[model samples]
Target: MNDIAAIPVWAIIPVSLLLIVGGSIVLIGALGLLRLPSFYQRIHGPAITVTLGAGCLLIASMIYFTVLQSRPVIHEIIISLFLLLTAPIVAMMIMRAAVYRDLRAGKKDAGAAAGGIYQFPEESE
Candidate 1:
């Protein structure tokens, strides 16, 4: 569009930079997702994308929109807030579920017992 090309060179540079950085963050998060071992580590991998990558992308969007319209637009904050609250809850639930499954399967060592882990009584077979 004509409007898109009409943006100042300086503004275009920053926007391009923002997009590059945001994309890099997302790429790193994806690599982390694939490289990290175990369910816990894998959970953390996507979280990096959810938190940092999403934040950077949102910032880039805000910058682009603000420059284009010359107005204050901040609706991204709502998304950030929802993600901040929900990501942790979702990650925690996944971790807890994995822990429960591991415990049930006796993969965890006996000395690893701690608070909040599920426990079962010994069976007399």
Candidate 2:
């Protein structure tokens, strides 16, 4: 007998809901990436949504697999931990790089809008 068939309807409902919600959140993030006007703004879409979406998907996988195996499957927790740790750091690094680049190019507005935290030497003409 296939393990998939062993999953009860009660377990299936939440798993399906998680998958759908996760997918929808990811789609919204993609749309935000495409629709947002600026790089600073665009990064937020994926950075925020990816974490939430992946979390939901991971939970769905855990529930589905646990139900199939008749055991508690918690490996997703580690994956989630890594993702939660890294995603924001990566996004911050990318934003910092962009801000640095903009500052080096004499665009003070970018640095200013970035809370004026970066100090770049003014280019002598």
Clashing pairs in 2: none
For model 1, what is the C-alpha lDDT against the true structure? Answer: 0.75
Q: Compared to the true structure, candidate 1 yields what TM-score?
A: 0.78
What is the lDDT, from 0 to 100, of the residue 38 in candidate 1? Answer: 61
- Judge candidate 2 against the unseen true structure and give its global Cα lDDT, from 0 to 1: 0.92
Tens digit of lDDT per residue, candidate 1, span 1-125? 98797677877787788788878888887888889866667777787577777777777787777778888878978887888788878877877777777777877442233454465666689
Best by the TM-score measure: 2
| TM values, all candidates | 0.78, 0.89
- How many clashing residue pairs appear in each of the predictions shown? 0, 0
Give the poorly placed runs of model 2, Cα more than 4 Å off: 115-125
